[model samples]
Target: MSGARHREEDLLRGISASAGMAIGPLRRYELPLPRVAETAADPAAERQALAAALETVAATLESARHSADAQGQQEEAEIFDAHLAWLEDPALREAAEHHIAAGSSAGQGWYAALQAEIERLRQSESALLAARVDDLRDLQRRVMAPLAADAGAAEAADDDLDGAILIAREMTPSQFVAVAGRIQGLCLAAGGATSHLAILARARGVPCVMGLGEALLSLTAERAVLDATHGVLESAPDAERLAALVAERERRQAQARSAAEQACAAVITRDGRQVQVAANVGSAAEAQAAARAGADGVGLLRSEFLFLGRAAAPTREVQRREYAAALAALDGKPVIVRLLDIGADKQLDYLSLPAAPNPALGERGIRLWQTFPELFETQLDALLLAGNEAPVADAATPLQLMLPMVSDVGELRWVRQRLAARAAELGITRLPALGVMIEVPSAALCAVSLAREADFFSIGTNDLTQYVLAMDREVAGLAAHCDVLHPGVLRLIQATLEGARGRCPVGVCGAAAGDPLAAALLVAMGVDELSLEPAGIAALKAWLRELDAAALAARVPELLALDDGAAVRAVLAAWLDASAPRGFGVMSERRGHTHNKQ
Candidate 1:
């Protein structure tokens, strides 16, 4: 195996969980999960032990829930709430007590009760019920902490790991939060690219590489260069190597700044293909900035932001004003607003969502509207109100509305009926361009059906990739296989395109759209629009200019035929290297050679 521990002047490689480069001191932090012990014990002692463990787990959950609620992490708080309910379940408490009374250790009792409950839930017809097994597993870790042999060590440590390249065997979601700002880079022996740890790492703008293997765990270097852009960790690097890395980092930052400077221009590929580059903004201020940056338009408004950070739901007029302000900021450009995609990762305090062990598959997205009619109706009313009041010139901007988590034609028909009713009620003849988000595997498969009724299609690759591979993006263990480049995900995108044919405009607004590599591939996939974060607009624009659409499009069949993400990446990398046109020394120097032939 090529994976080896570097004692001195050597390099280790792993998956790039985040894109960036960091030079920092190496700090090792290990938070070992406590092991459950099963042993015979007196009924009295077992009861006492069980009670203590329950108290600790409950207190921890309640604290986290309250803290999350205060910090606008309402969605995260729901996760803790579910754990608290499980702890207070009468049946679960009774089962555990029975085991304790039977002379089982507290750990044994707790494990038995959790397993029995999970098994019962798994037998249910509902898929959400079956998914609760993960929640139960997460609870076991927290509950077992106080009961484990190393309970004292489970407590918080005093060391500060900020500004350090954190190395660990595995990191939980909580660990990422604790050392968030302080950690300049992250290296883990476990978890995958799309794990919760990886997600947080990226959000914090920290360079992170995971699934690095066992040798990295014992790394004791005081300082190292963590190049997460390419997933390379260098220890005791030669001076020459350090200088080269530093220079490369600077060049990338320069390129990023230049891309932003040229943000207002249209991005056309070398093969003469024009791609619409847009932004995903949450507020009017961001919308204004996107316009200044020269974005084609807003891709996703994340309308849930309107309902969050408040004690009650905002009035319909309140939503309309906010939506109107954002539309005005766009300066007549088209904006695609996805209505209230809450429940999984995003939640609203006013909405009473059922506690699900796995909320991602729960009553979220378009499902939330069906369960709560008023929610969807009010939002639709606001969109129509804002649309009708828009100026004649900007009215051509088209207030595009998109539905999320739609599974079947019935759901589309139901929402369309509501939209038409709202438009009629408002005495509006021209309704906005209505669209469905092709996120769920079902919608992708039934795209032709949805296209026949809808005005346009916006593919949400984030949820689509996760569901297509059956990998939860939040699960650290499943990160490796959660890539959008997976053949299955690409096939589904192709499926949606084929089914829709030339019937509707298709756009991609997920994280994939923001990625330069994925953005290139997406255009090659014949995607009409590419919506990315504001910051990536320039590089993506520059990156687009490097691509030959016909060259990329012609190889679509071969690329789709490849079953492995790694194979797909290799093909694209080779193509980019070969086809990259000669540019200023800035971009070409980084690639080591110019595209002289091109």
Candidate 2:
């Protein structure tokens, strides 16, 4: 482990949470834990004390959630939602009750319960589950401090962290939120790449590296070079390396400024073919960010954000408000909102779905909607109501509705009939365009038939690649195999376009769309639109402006003939190295390294 820590010699190794470089003074910021007694004198009083502490924590989390929502910080609000859910979990309560009944104090019982839960999660095979251990520890501290009457752990410090690289054993989401903007970068001794801290760091464009273990905690150097792009921390850099890093930092800043300046410009290939660059957002905040980043439109509005991680489904009025807020953020830009695509990996405790051997291949998305038509109708009504509220300045770009997991034309027709019925019921005359998401092999194979009924087609490459390769996306150790750049997935994409036959615009909204290398190949294949996350829009557009799509088109036949993903990636890398413009060095080096919170 020590050898791995210094893999490159004199540099501490870790996983990159965000891509960037930062050279600054190192500052250690630790959140102390409250000590607790092992046993209690009164069991009844201990139980009551535990109950009160739970209520306090829940109320605090709820307040934080509302504050985040009011501030248009959707991801920050969702982090609180997970904490609140844990507070309401029956298993967690039972675990604490058992400990209290065994003659333990409220703080001790809660601490033990959370520690056990954290250990269990750490033993899980899923990285997502393991990454949640910090959250559980956070809850333990929150509840324990209240029971122990210790206010020190929860108080905010006034320490100045400006332009300093923060070092910690682990960080909670709330802690990260408080110091996100003040810090230059982050280095965690124990944390996962998928942790909420990492997500916040990436979103804020803060250079971050995690999972360095005790080696990071042993660092006593006052200054360090944090190269998050390569996931290495250098405590002492020579004069020449320091100078090079400074120049590199200036170059990156200049590149970012240039990209932002050209974000709103049309992405026309050198050969004069226009390609739409849109954003895939989940909330009004994300949509607004996309618009500000110069996205042409919202290509995929993940409506599930409004429904998931809740005690109950959102009301029609609530749904209407959320949708309208997102639409208003886009102003006149086109927005495609996907219907409720839940069940499977995303489950609601209130809705007890039937158990399946493999949830990924089970009844999900449109299939689940079919089982609960009332839920479907409620969302449809809300969307139509929002659409009827106010007219956009650009009438041509209306709110469009998309259906997910449609395997054939029948599903498209079924959704269209339902959409029309709901619109008519609400006295709405102008129906939004209806589209189908090409995710399943059957749907891609039958794109021609479905295209006749649907208004547009969006390829969800994330799902399509997993299905095509017969790999479960959520399973550990399959990320390399589940890559969308595989020749098999590319072939399916080509087939989908061929089936569409220019009857409707074909857009790629999956994770691959955000990748520059994949984006170039997508353009080469004649894809009409590329929709990715908001932060990536500027860089992607800047890169796309340098390519000649017609010239790329001539190489498609050869690219499709490649045997595997590695081969395709090698070809794209060589092409980028030879053809990318001089000013796009950052963009070229960043290709094929897209990191998204899946």
Candidate 3:
């Protein structure tokens, strides 16, 4: 007899995360646990079972680590490493043994012990350790929940659910590692898009739907199609729907690959103006990938990754090694490293500060630097050392020094004086050009004064918009005013650029720079350079290559002349609508042809 044919169908969905389609097999995983009887008599055997269970968990973590490493998922591998450590901990094993001796079955004993530890940790005063302990306990429950179910079943169930929808109340990092490649799309009963699970999904290029409620329970194995982009769960999809979905997925994948290729190409404007494209990276692996992706340099190197979650402050030597590795990977490209910008949002017990009612407006960025001079000095010393030992390049790589959250001229002078003293102490001769981030409204207003003391200006539009409009981007109710295109925010940017007065170069390294229309508007306002996320490089470049900045510049004064925000936005929108279609479309459509012949 011939094997049954599998029919494909088309599925239409929403774009929940704002990216394009990604079609892969559905990979699913359920948290499993070992079976347990109500009564227990064999204490020695129970101990042995616990040890064996630990061994199994360790093996599972190792396998996951290896698989993630092979796939170039370093962050996933790190998650597994944490699981491995938890499984091997003597304290955790001892707790399980004690529970077994108290007359519980093996699986029950393990679950009980884990729950007790979790409760204790959650109640602890140390928020950092409490968070970690909660995470570990959550993983234990997820990893063992399914195994426990199978123990009660008549036969062993399959661990691998190839390309299946993962329907779960929640997912822990370790559970995510255990079923890494087996899941196609994830549907959680509850979670925010920025939650750890969603973050992991985005990083791994997996489709996910969070806060799906109890609708996930109705989904059977390999019988339902989940359109994550649109939040639709189609039970028993027809052939036509499946076929359409598959085709759409393929098209999306092709578009992403094409975009990536284009991002690696040079960024040139319609008038032949060239702007360097770079990536914002946080780790060694990311730095290397950014380099491979044809990023001109590292625009923002967030150093918090090294400091956060550490039991003690990372030694100067360790900090140096991390920075040095990133510099080496850039191969002499300028890497703008920002000092630690922690606050109530990211509180460290070691660097204790009173709990604030509003952290965003409280001690953060340069404020923290002023409060904790020693910590700031250590980081400054390490960064300067990294710059001194950085490899020589064919061209002079402008290793610009950037200070975050400087609101006035005094902050600039304070940072420079400290840098001078530190340099003299270290016996350094030359220093990299110093720059200040224009993120505060006051800084924007006082740009000309601040610019006199700095070598360059990089506008952080994210915070600038938030501060200017007095609107929180996270709050959906205020999203209308939170836009970067708001007249007030645009005026601030214009003023800052005008204040520079061609003395020092000005660039924008923010989400606004990545948007095609926003980039055009900024260029019109005379921004010298634009830095965006690596993924947005191609689309932004395509728009830039079609825009005549001189023409845009001519129109910008008129656009800004209007005092009404709505009027200004309308004029700019109308101008773009009339000019962009033919200009941008034709240029992007012909880019491949021109580049191939060259």
Using all chains and alpha carbons, the TM-scores for the candidates as numbered come to: 0.69, 0.87, 0.74
Indicate the residue-level lDDT of 54 in model 2: 95
- Top candidate by TM-score: 2
Q: Write the per-residue lDDT of candidate 3 for residues 195-251, one digit (tens) a residue.
A: 445546756656666555655554454455565544445555556656765665565
Candidate with better lDDT, 2 vs 3: 2
Residue 480 miss distance in model 3 (angstroms): 6.7
For every candidate structure, what is the RMSD over all alpha carbons to the true structure, in angstroms? 8.2, 4.1, 7.8
Q: After superposition, how far is residue 181 of candidate 1 from its true place, in Å?
A: 8.7
Regions of model 1 farther than 4 Å from truth: 1-18, 27-219, 229-241, 354-358, 394-397, 583-598
Per-candidate Cα lDDT values, in order, are 0.73, 0.81, 0.65
> lDDT of candidate 3?
0.65
Worst 10 residues of 2 by lDDT: 1-10
Instruction: Return the candidate ranking by lDDT, descending.
Output: 2, 1, 3
- Evaluated at residue 50, the lDDT of candidate 2 is 91
